[model samples]
Target chain A: MDPYALKKLNQCRRERRAALLVTDLGDGRDRVVVEGDPVSGLLGEAVEKAFRSDKSATVEVDGRTFFLNVHLPPPRLVMIGAVHISQALAPMARMAGFDVHIIDPRTAFASPERFSGVRLDAEWPEEALARSPLDAYCALAALTHDPKIDDPALMAALEAGCFYVGALGSRKTHAKRVERLTAAGVPSSAIERVHAPIGLAIGAASPPEIAVAVLAEIIEALRSRGLEARKGEAA
Target chain B: MPEEVQSEPLDPLMTAEDWMKAGKDVAIATVVETWGSAPRPVGSHLVIDGEGHFEGSVSGGCVEGAVVAEATDVLSDGKPRMLEFGVADETAWEVGLSCGGRIKVYVERLG
Candidate 1:
């Protein structure tokens, strides 16, 4: 590897940016393409495909084989509640390769002993979100039934274009929430983005089962949106 | 940026880079493609140093021995090699890939 490529790779790693390292097997020459860079050829198409799939691949372009090594930033999960469900969700999310963070204003619930080996932010949702803005690669879950905490976090997630925004509540609760959000000047379209009655209909009645359903739904949302966006770009 | 998030350890690439800095010859084997029933997904990596120590997995222990052997060659010669093993290829049983899947791994010496 050239010094310049290594430097760029280290920089991308430091900045948590997604990149693809292209190695031309014919000549052993390497090139690095960071996310959002203009890629304008067959190699560009390959890189774009790899980026969309989030998988490295061996692609043959014009009879020359090139290996696209994808380096993606870790997916992030921000849970707006340090409740029992979060206890199950945090470890599962971490195992699924997400950088998980649990936030709550309640010091007792978000205590260090409760979430050993997990990141906990014992601050209000709005304040926590202000410090670490959500991005498209993030999945936000408002697990606390309290409107004071969950609503602000949901709004912040929507504003940040989080890939998944789910709120744990009943349909009636969500209806009441819609009214509150609408009265608070939130647009209907934005309010609709929240996946109320959170998690898949897996008949999950326990915390661990509910955690599985929620993570499954989050993965579904992330992959479907990514695939759709890539299809639109390819079209 | 909170201190906790910043204090999180970097990923495996950084570990490989540190190994190189520490004067250990390192080679990385990446799963570039896979067929049916592959244990590890595409983009999975196994980083091996000159002493046969490895981090990460390419086949969930079904093929690490062979990959490490090939990586040793790559480290010695600095030559990049693309290797393919599968049940359909008859070498799969010998390599312990008997779970019926094909995988193409690209092994390269890293600086």
Candidate 2:
């Protein structure tokens, strides 16, 4: 093991940052250990912190000091539509560490089989979003491709102060969306925050590819939000 | 990966300079800013010592040479300096930093 990995591990242990031990299998594969076998390698509270994903924790190992972010970033994905993109996106977002949730009045589209392992709400947009609640850390995306569904969700997300709000469509479609949202009592500034034509310009065409692009944009937004928060704290 | 055992704990929010000023000799390199998809966050700090020891990270193993070089200079001069690395820098992509993220590190010596 390189000293760097050891040093990182020590710091993470001290700070209670969740760390996985990477074991090379010599076959383009690696094994991960959360707390070692019998968890004996973890000294004191480091083991406990790893399990809990604590924020701001400290651990001592091998005469080194480790500081860790015990708090795991729990990002929420609020999807307004239960379309193909949503289906493709839900699983991928979960893999990327998002708590996926879907809202749509159409129960047929928002079903257990369609959105398995996701929080599905078969209710009107306003009702569903109010029940689930929203926070500054949440990422709200409208993909219904229908103004009726997407607009209401956008209103709910904006009112709840979501960190990232995006809608899928062309530039022309987005302009119309902006107009409708503005007329619906949503402030233009608040509506401006929505990332229309949502996602990086990867020129994606397929649903899966679009999901990839959109999720990438979401992560970037999340990172930027974190930087801003840090700056605010410093200020 | 082999885990290291810790002896002394330090504050995560404090940079290496802050730690050194408190009486512990420390060398720190910090990522002041970043652009694009950087693996590590800006304001990320890496602290080193006279024994060739260190903590934290600036890049995902990329641009480490430059950071080490700057850290060494800080240790010798007993002063602080800033460093930049990214896809924009000709030498950075060679070090495997291809994410197009730009990082500025402030290396400071504290004692």
Candidate 3:
């Protein structure tokens, strides 16, 4: 427990930076690799791989085994409606290791009783998003099916580069929504990022089932995006 | 295997740091690899103090006892050990991983 390493680790945690602590089993030497730091060393490739996957691993470097301990900021989920689907989605998302927040200008639906252990922002999506900016680790879901509510949030999520942006609606509804977004000056490529029909094709007929499908789609997006980003880096 | 217990979102590194700050010897076991029906995913952690108290789960309940035992040694020797348990391993049945899955855990003393 070197004081220097401990200090750096605490700093990284405070800064919400992803990092890896590479520990050489042979000599008990430890080195910290904060995200965006150079990965050129004995543990370079393995560290890079671990960073991309956000998974820790034991790697053999030049015949010496080392453990890469990964530290990542918690994933966040921002829901743009306090509808029934959100009631189901919030708890499930929290259970899956996400910091869940629900934003709805409609205070009646966004009351504490509806979302009992979740953070609620009874403000408009734009105001809530401005207060808590979305990051690359965030997933945004628009479930109200009200363009006035969902469209602004989707636009904000796109601008913020959220890892996942999904909206609940039928294909026709999304088509109309896309047209409105395009008319509203959202780029076609950005509009393409929305996962309309929101969830996977799970034939979800109930709110809980729909919530499951949506969460699964969000996780898929997160993992697939990580893989694609890693591939792009390799290329 | 023990029934899977739902864990709240608590940061393992922070927990380990708090334990260390409180002057307790601690070891952390991480699931580095898994194959088939592994209860926990890679990067899952179980922090163990010298007195056998622990937080988090590296393998639901299948091989936690063995991991905790090895973590005790890690705390004493300040050394790290990589352990493997699965249906294919000799201690799999003894450790109750009978549901069939392989998991590699790396246990080490954490400051």
Candidate 4:
């Protein structure tokens, strides 16, 4: 691999972007393909697959074998509340291979003892997000139920194109949320994506069960990522 | 992908660039392919300097010595090499992967 390619690949990784280091196994020539970088032909299709699946593999294209080394930013779960649900979510998401961060301005709830090894932020969502920022690879769950805490976060997640954005609320609560979001000019289409009454309808009544539902929903959003785009193309 | 804090010190590719920038002749060995129970996954990297000093792993400590030795040769010749290691041939290599898995490691000099 070329040194330049290595540097570029590493840069993408550090910045939490997807990149592929495609090396021609026959000639040792290599290049870095960042996400959304146009690649054509059979190799382009293979690279697209690699980006979606986050798998590295050797592909035979035009009688030449190329090793496509996929480097994807690890998926992250950011919770808007440090309540019982988030306490359950923090550890559960970690076990589910997500980097979990819980943000709550309530210092009592954000205590380290409750969070243990999880990243706990005793700050409001806008302030915390301004420092760290959200990206496409992140999943944001507004578990606070209070719009004061959850609305800014929901808007930010929608704006950032978070793979999953779910808010904890009943249908009645979500109706009001929709009105508020529309009043705030968060386009009706963007507001539509928030999975209100968050999580899979698994009849989850307990905090841990709710965590499982939310996690499953997040995983579904992650795995079924491109299917919606394909649907758009079909339309 | 569990977000293990990717501390730069733990990454072999970052180390390769640091080593190269420090004027040390370096070679990088990457696991190109692996079959059945291979300890390291494909795209795992090991960077070796000319002195046989190495960082990272191509196997579960079972095949590093051989890969490091070959990395020295690649560094000297400025050529790339593909090495296959497995329990398939104990006599063929100086050492074999005792884990009963096969792996192909691609070794090349880092520019």
How many steric clashes between backbone atoms does each model show?
0, 23, 0, 0
Top model number, TM-score: 4
DockQ comparisons of all candidates to the true complex: 0.39, 0.02, 0.23, 0.40
Q: TM-score of model 3 relative to the true fold?
A: 0.77
Which candidate comes out best when scored by lDDT? 4
Candidate 1 clash pair list: none
Model 4 accuracy (lDDT, Cα): 0.89
lDDT of 3 at A45: 80
Candidate 4, superposed: residue stretches over 4 Å from native = A226-235, B1-9, B90-94
What is candidate 3's local distance difference test score?
Answer: 0.84
TM-score of 1: 0.83
Candidate 3 per-residue C-alpha lDDT over B1-111 given as tens digits, one digit per residue, 9 for 90 to 100: 111123445766677788888989988887877889889887788989999988889887888889889998899988788899988887756895766889888787875
- Model 3, chain B only, scores a TM-score of 0.87
Tens digits of lDDT, candidate 4, B47-71? 9998888899989898898899888
Task: Write candidate 2's Cα lDDT for B1-111 as tens digits.
Answer: 111121233533244444444555566665655668877874366777665566677888787766776777777877667677777777754664777777766666543
TM-score of chain B of 2: 0.71
Worst 10 residues of 4 chain B by lDDT: B1-10
Cα misplacement distance, residue B20 of candidate 1 (Å): 2.2
What lDDT score goes with residue A89 in model 4?
82
The TM-scores that each candidate's chain B achieves against the reference are 0.86, 0.71, 0.87, 0.88
lDDT of 2 by residue, A51-133 (tens): 34323333456765333323233678988888899999988998897878888788789777887667788787888766567
